[model samples]
Target: MALWTLFGLRQGSATTRWPAPGGDDGQADVLGMPRYHPERCGDGCSACADACPTGAIVADAAGGLEVDYSRCIACQLCVEACPDGAMTASGDWAFGVRRREDLRWAESGDPPASPAPTAGYRRSLHIRHVDAGSCNGCESELQALNNPIYNLHRLGIFFTPSPRFADLLLVTGPVTNAMIEPLKAAYEAMPEPRWVMATGTCAVSGALTGGGYAAQQGLGDILPVDVWLPGCPPNPAAIIEALLMFLDRMPQRVRGGQYGE
Candidate 1:
């Protein structure tokens, strides 16, 4: 134990100072959410929509293309398929949204206005995680939040086993019927001012394979979601940014399914 302690000391702190401006937040070279420039889209181009595996993009008579970020897997197929420069890779991994409609984009789609934090979560948040029917990819990233590198505790966030003590319910995966009742029960147990965050593509839109009777749709279909973060499984840095976005500590990078201003 003593030898290990010395080794630990030698290793020092690998904690990333994210959410603040300076330290390594692990965002460098990360493939983030996609951006959209309607003006750059060809007049009748529908390539991006056709190439999207999840049907997240659809041809829009008005906007040229309508994008639904909730169903987006960030495969970048749309980017590769586009002949024009409408859809480009962006530096926006923090796609946490307070309103679901913000995930959609139409030419006439107005920018989703930011909403104030309604849960009264002024400082520090304890999260209660529930996996309805995940394939375990999301869980792997969640595990990294506790590692020495991320050190999520430094940001005043914690994961608790009981919902009673939690201020936020961070859910991953489709809502399976068997887990629906239990999930509701957990929510009911939590005190008021509680918040719910759908943390991945499965939890946000239930994906393509998640529409059976055994599995309900997504978290929004079952319970109210205060935040929607969509990815096949958002990386560890994205997860932290989503959580911080929920707390109103970070600006939302996504509006109307497109990144940037």
Candidate 2:
């Protein structure tokens, strides 16, 4: 333990100054969800939809294609399958939103305005995480938040064991049948003015494991969600951005299935 402590001291401060303007949020070369180009799509093309594992890309009623960000696992399958340049890979990963409709791709119209941040949770926020039916992928990323490199506590976000003291409920996995009652019990234990964040693609739209015998269609099937973060397992920086966005400290970057819109 003494040698390890000495090694830690020598490494100095490993935490990043991310989420601050001009700071590095890590994810330098990482490719996020695919970018959809409606103009490039062919009239009879459904290749992207056919290749998608999560049903994130589908044919609309107007003989057009629609991309839903919530169900996307960022596997880049659609990008590879598109004969045209319609579905292309991108680096736009900071996908946190207040409304579910904001995650869908629409050619026109604006998304519904999100409510202002609660006054009580501006500076500090307490989170209680529940694994409804996770595959442990999201939990692995969540554990990294406390490591020396990420150091989640520096941003005033913390995980609490007790729901009564938590300001937000962070849920993972595809809301399985067995865990539904337990998940509700945790929500009921929390005080009023509480918020819920769907932390992964499973929690956001259940990804590939949804609609089976046990799993439901993510947390929206059971709880009122204030934030929806979609990824197979979102990186640490993306998670931070989502939480901050939920607190209204950061702007929602993805709207109508487009990034930076």
Candidate 3:
């Protein structure tokens, strides 16, 4: 025990002070969501759209690229596939939003100019996670919140094992047909003034499993969502930032799927 304590003291405080200035978390150099400059695209180019494994980059009827941030997994294939300089790699990882439409490139707008926290959870937030049918990448990232680096517990946010004591439902997966009832039941179990967060591309936009005969279109299509954190699986730092933003501990950096100051 003494040896372990000595090792712990040597390690010191590994927790990040990010979202509090003067802190460089691990995501600074990581490639986050891809940014698109539609004006730079070719007149009728469909390269980016074709390269997207998910239907994230579909072509609109007017021949314009429709990039949905929710379905995007940061695969970067679209960036490499674009013949023109329209799609460029970016470090914009903070993709959480209060509205589902904000996940669309064309429709996204800056978050409301208010720092007002969610009424009941301004200081502390408790989340209940449900995996309807996820591929588990999101789950891996979620677990990182407890690591020494992120130290999510320091922010007064905890993952309760039961929905009945939770203030928010942080859901992952594609909302499979087999899990819809359970998901809803979990949501119902949460206390009043409860909110729902769609965490991951699959839960926000249903990824590859959407519109199937046996599953739901997305979490928002089935339940009223208060926040949408989209990624193939949002990185640990991104997830922490999103949760803090929801708690009013930080400002929202994403508007209309574009990262900003």
Candidate 4:
């Protein structure tokens, strides 16, 4: 019976190399924001600026473009508005911070710590994930880490089911009322010197459904968020970038200006 069960395991599947199509290869994009080509830009039409849902893109008198990524929604609207294809979205996605002030716009804080030089300093992190009330988008991306393409284990990062053994807590969803106690208990159960990572728009700023009755306060209101992964359930590569950013394995960016400015 044991041999039959062992034989039941699926095998003989083709294996792909690291960074299988559409996988992040650990290269941080120094230019974390999008870049615009002025030559390809036409006159000051303001279509891209108007199309911007968050008003991240603006036009100048010289028919040039300005993008405040701190406000940009990364909706790709500007890329679609450019008739000449002047706007292009770059893959550079490393963005993480240790303090809210560091992430806050118009607030200059102390510089982040320099990345550890030796790979040995990179600790093996055991992550515990909790779904407060997410739409399951964040969970989907989290699962991608197990895929051979991303292979998070290569970096010594792992996901564990038990919170007691976890070194980091990866949370999804906007802290719903029903989940508050569970979330708090989970954090309290973990060992000291632990980290909490809030992934997705719901967990970060609450995004659209923040004011809902079921939604509790933001993740920050409940716990000290060590990392914030902003997106409507960010892409797999984006998740990898955020995780790497938190570990100080990539360059960090200090965005300027106000939150809604």
Q: Could you tell me every candidate's TM-score relative to the true structure?
A: 0.90, 0.95, 0.93, 0.65
- Steric clash pairs (candidate 3): 108-256, 109-256
Candidate 1 matches the true fold with a TM-score of 0.90
Q: How should the candidates be ordered by TM-score, best one leading?
A: 2, 3, 1, 4
lDDT of 3: 0.85
Model 4: ten consecutive residues of lowest lDDT: 252-261
Q: Which runs in model 1 stand beyond 4 Å of their true positions?
A: 61-63, 106-112, 118-120
Question: lDDT per prediction?
Answer: 0.83, 0.89, 0.85, 0.66
| Ranking of predictions according to lDDT | 2, 3, 1, 4
Give one digit per residue, the lDDT tens place, for model 4 in 1-261: 687556655543222333344533553553233445556767776778777765456776777666544344456778777777767766545444445444433333344454422234466778999998898987887887777566778767888989999988888888888999999999999987788987876777665556578796459889988776666556666676567667766545544322210
Error of 4 at 16 (Å): 8.2
Candidate 3 local lDDT, 1-261, one digit each (tens): 699899999999988887578876778778988998988989889999999988889988898988889898899999999989799999888888777667788544564554434844554788999998888999999999999888888889999999999988999998999998999899888888888889998898888887789778779878888888988789988888888778776777777767786
> In terms of lDDT, which candidate is stronger, 1 or 3?
3
**Tens digit of per-residue lDDT, candidate 2, span 1-261:** 699899989988877877776778788899998999999999989999999989998887888987899999999989999999999989988998888898999776367777845644655889999999999999999999998778899889999999999989999999999999999999999988898999999999989998899899899979999899999899888899898888778888877877883
